[model samples]
Target chain A: MKNRYDIVVVGAGPGGSMAAKVAAMGGLDVLLVEKRQEIGSPIRCAEGVSKKGLKKFLPQIKKEWISCEVEGARIYSPDGTMVEMAEEMAGSEVGYVLERKIFDRDLATLSGDAGADVYAKTNVTDLVLKDGVVKGVKGKHLGRSFEVECNLVIGADGTESKIGRMGGIDTTLKPIDIESGVEYIMTDIEVNDLCNFYLGNDIAPGGYAWMFPKGDNMANIGLAVLGKYLIKKNVKRPIDYLNKFVKEHYKDGKIVSVVFGGIPVSRPIKTISNGIMLVGDAARFTDPITGGGILKAMESGIMAGETAIDAIEAEDFSENELKKYEDKWRPTIGMKNERNYLIKEFFINLSDEKLNDLARSINEVKIKEMSVTGLIAMLIEKNPKTLENLSEILLKYL
Target chain B: MIYVDRYKCGYCGTCVAVCPEAAIDLLETFIDINDNMCKACDICVKICPIGALVDEE
Candidate 1:
């Protein structure tokens, strides 16, 4: 560890690593820190990302990083009515299940090769704020404490984003907008090439269940319940929800690995502050509908990296200069997030009867492709009552 | 009182972010919840996916 650097990126996840890589490649001295001893171990994701989403950033998908390549998706309603769609129309976690342990580490290695000082087992305890402007970070590396000054601080910290809070950025998520989730890496069950999504308030209130195959006969089975749903009787921790899912579905399956996490299912929060920027889950950039952040994390990282260089060249690290980072993401990913949030809100509130009806209607069409516009038209023709309770966007058309 | 069941804990740090008081801290493999700052909100308890965080009996 150095005493100073041009920029300091907290967390070694994909977002931070990409930011550090881009900044270092641009000739800026960068420091990347990860609290964990290993770059990626204790996997937190369902490990699924759209094929096109990953392709936008990486040159090519490495074979080892992929566990499975799904061709489409299967969405089942409470009554078991199934609506199938090709991968092109699948939301976020459809196309591929990645080995994040390898993928996250490789990204950090790329940043290191680009001249960023990447350090694992490094923890950022606090931000060095000078008059409410983030000046640097104070933390420990291998049992040694140090304070390093920097012109810019990029917080790529995930769901539990203390870095953003320490830098005076509010990253609070309401119970309705936060999902408590768990997953089990199960084997000894027949798996298919398509990802499966199950919906019903009875199965997982305020959320949904999914099974993403990971090759062979293994699959990742998981479900998340929004915080708002937890307050209801008999619904406590997400483990209970996962247990219900396993009992009913994967009862004969073997549990090899158990994982727990919380996904922020909210629209984008403020991502930039004075001399500070947040990327990935820290910025609440995860897709509101799918709770997927891998693609958006990399997107924000690239923008943050470019914005950092722009600020450095202008000799201005003020919020005014850093605003470009958020501005860059707003029109692109931000709009989609807001729209998805509304759709998620509506979907979660729907009755099981409605979900089953919609599923049957969509399945009946037997379409080759699933497009939003086409689905809207089909829904209006087949199930007009369901559209009556839609949010602002659809109501305008009605 | 030990509120954290270490055996069940995965330490993903979800409790730390959702803490309204900012009372919880994730330290490597373990998570520390500062009692002084905690208000027994049970938010972390309900949200803990693995049932690692339990409400004090």
Candidate 2:
């Protein structure tokens, strides 16, 4: 890595790598650093993505990156009512279960091929600022301290984004806006070619339990809840919920890999400060209701990459110069995130009785399309009185 | 002070996100909870998957 570069992208998840790749592809000097020794090991995500989303951002699907291609989804309400939807109608998260390790590494390689210097095991401990503007980063590489000066810093680091916070971007995540998640990659389990969701307050509190199939007999069983749900509510932790679900459902499955992390279910940060840009989970780009982020991360990474190029050309790294990014992403990613956050707020606040009523109403008939908005629209028509209090919020998304 | 059990800690960084005080961080090998910055709210302790964080009361 160079002592100085045009841009320093921190964290090698999808967001950082894509930013580096797009910037380097624009002929800017770029350095991508990942804190881990290996690119995408000790996996943390649920590893599911949309085939349509993949085709939109990713160049082409590599055989090695896929775990399975599920046909659709089955959502269970608190009353055990199931609503089945086809993969095309199952919304953005239902098509492919990725081996994220392979997918993330491949994206980083794409960045390297585009001429960005990529280094793993380099931890960015601090940012170097001059006159209140970020100029570089200080960290350790291979057990030795290292520093690199850059005109811009892309904080693609995940949910707990210290870079964003240090760079004067408010990365504050409220307990209610954060979802603590844990997943177990299981083998020799019973599952079909469908992604399954079980929703209930008693089972998952402020979130849901999911089984995203990795194969016919393998799946990732996971649970996530807002921190408030777990904060002194008789439940000690999130794992307790997952353990109980496993005992009741997939008790015979063998655990292969375990991963845990937090997802920001809040709106995107209000601003991107001078010389600093937050992408992916760092920017709270994960979908609020579904907690899915790969596609959003890639989209924001591309936007950040494009912004970096413009900043270098104009030689202006001011927040004004970066406003074009907000201009481009806000309408797309930002507005979508805002809509979803509102929807998330509405859903999580619903009592089990309301959820079951809504789910039963949804199950009573076959909706032609089964997206989040479609489901809520169906509820509006079916249980107008029950959801009347929340219809004002969900209506805009429709 | 909140004591994080390093052995059971999954280093998932969940604690770091939910920490309104921004006291917890995922260090190189383990999670580091800065006592001086901690407010002892136990929000991190409640959210941790393994219950690795403890309010040392």
Candidate 3:
């Protein structure tokens, strides 16, 4: 006899955990499986989350998960031009650099508290299907293979989710759309309680370097380079570039931990099939412009959870029914991702010289408050001459 | 032997940096694999700064 669940969510990241939480809350029998022995252990992220976006989904911030409360961010040009602003002025600026271990555990606890069965070290190796409708999952844990049945399946695995691909959802991303990221947790550095962004070709070809403050003397320093750019330039690893930047920028710091990962910058794919729905990085739910997905993952997980309940009650686990989850989010959350893709294209094609000039122009503006969108627009408006150049570059690359 | 496309090398020196055999000479635009000194560890092939170098199978 096989074990059973109303919903089985693969990957116990923020998205999967949140989906389990919502489904279990709605009186559904939910099971969450994570491949890692511990959730959030091999920290692969920069751990930054905007307060505004976070508040839109989660009612309150849990105290234990916050590493530091940031006031705003400083944007720097290649030659070191700087533009500083207050968090209130930029809605997306004020954020918390999280302790993801605590954060991820809390989400799983939320699911378990809501009556979901959570399993770590259980790897979902394959999807079990009956006549083109997903019926369950085949996995291994503790050196034993098992099959677990579920009416609906939610795939929230990260960038390398094989579960989504097995369901035939066309989840493969182009190399140019995937960012190969490397980061270092460094100590003995003096940093203000604000995030710092460095932009220029010298640091990253199609992405930027970030210094996210964790404390007065420690920070997460990292860079994201498009994988295509890495291949194009024949670099050894993205972290090598990050290390050079640290030596030049924060000379006194010593790296304590190094992490490498990838961020998907593509718009959310059409990620639903019969009895299946994909959420989080598996669906490329990450914001293309900023590479932030924790909040988006949580939002989509909530939607997926509620939708899973409907599918289970209908007893008709069809493609059309599962697609409602995608439809509900496609217009709002999906649209934002599409817009951010355009912005990412505009930023990635800029040369180091152009970025420095753009930064200088931005610093000259007496703007008090701006959205990340608004700031980019202001740069274009102030330097009308660059718009044509930007358009040309965008046409060639995007 | 390792083959390199000269055009793609950005001289980021990653191959030189990661080479355990110290067989690569960091150049302005690329690295020169010293065959005499090269042990063919394949680290340079994996860590090529621009991914310009490939090992012949």
Candidate 4:
């Protein structure tokens, strides 16, 4: 294997693979490395992506990658009151539940086909730094230590992004800004085409539990609780919550697989660093409210790839050149993340009674005609007492 | 022996991911640490996001 490349991408997730593919397509020597023996194994995500968001980047998705095409969602309140919305009304909330194993492998395969060299089980241990500038990475590839030099490194590692830290970026999360999640892939159950979200303090304090249907008899049932709430409730792990939820709901469902991971619910860092760009969870690009990142990861990956190419063409791989990625992603996905953060904060503070009230109000509204601001306005009108709690949020969002 | 704090665990499976020996198994309701498989390397203790896993005194 070559010991040097123009660009070396760490972590062959969606973001890394996408960056590699685009950079390789631009005729750059790109190396995409994965610590895992397999490109995508022991998947961590619930694997749900809205068709609208995905189609914007990927023109057409292959059929094999999609496990289930959901038409809508059923949101359950604490008291089990359900409020359902169709895909169109739900907007970005509805789409395909992907087979992430296949999706991730396909992404890596695409990067390879685009002329990027891909390696698995190549764990990057540390950054190869020259005068505080990231020149490359040193790691073990199949038990042999190797150092690969590159002009630029893309940290597409997930939430636990070691590369981001090695590049001198603070990727730490406040307890409130971390969502600890656990999920079970279960079969021998009946699930509709509608994806389901259960909200209430009892279910998943500071977050929500979800049932993303993969098929009529199978689904990825999971819950994410805010780190702060987990400690507050004296909850041991997210799996405990999952166990309780499953016992109540899917008593007959047999567990086929289990997955767990953390989601960063905080804002993106101010600077991702020079000569090293961070994408996906490494950059904290996932939505704070939904904990959904696949779309944003790919989107930012494309932006980073294009920016890297531009930087290479300009013969400047400085922070100034890499700042273009931050500039481009901020106004688009970054703004949405900020808004979602506000929404998440608001939801986290509400009591179960308040959530029930909110759900009841939502049930009465014509959700299709209601914007987020409009919904807030309606909530205040219906429950005038909630004005004190919601006025500030309304002022900002409305 | 490894100690798992039942209250602090969010069961994100970071321990399992980092454990070289695969000593940790996330069961239906809790994380099971196999004593035979555990090398007390403390990788799980360090990797735990919620600081749920601990080494016995």
Which candidate achieves the best TM-score against the true structure?
2
Q: Is candidate 1 or candidate 4 better by TM-score?
A: 1
DockQ of each: 0.73, 0.76, 0.04, 0.13
| Model 1 TM-score on a 0 to 1 scale | 0.94
Per-residue error at A3 for model 3, in Å? Answer: 1.0
- Would you list the clashing residue pairs of candidate 2? none
Comparing 2 with 4 on DockQ, the higher-scoring candidate is 2
CAPRI-style docking class of model 4 based on DockQ: incorrect
Better of 1 and 3 by DockQ: 1
| lDDT, candidate 4, A1-398, per-residue tens | 69789899988889999999999999999999997787778788999888877788778789989999887767788998777666354334458999999999999999999999999988787888999887888988988999988889999977767666677776666666778788899999889887789998888888899999998799999998787765443345667778999999999999999777888889767535778898998788989878999989998898999998998899888888888999999888888788778877877888888788778876855544213344556667777776655666556643
DockQ of 3: 0.04
- Candidate 3 regions with alpha-carbon error over 4 angstroms: A88-93, A388-398, B1-56
RMSD of 4: 5.4
Please list, in the order the candidates appear, how each scores on TM-score for chain B only: 0.92, 0.91, 0.81, 0.90
Model 3 chain A weakest 10-residue run by lDDT: A389-398
- Note the Cα lDDT for every prediction shown: 0.84, 0.86, 0.78, 0.80
lDDT by residue (A156-210, candidate 2, tens digit) is: 9987788888888878787888889888999998888777899999778788899
Query: Residue A388 of candidate 3: its Cα lDDT?
Result: 68
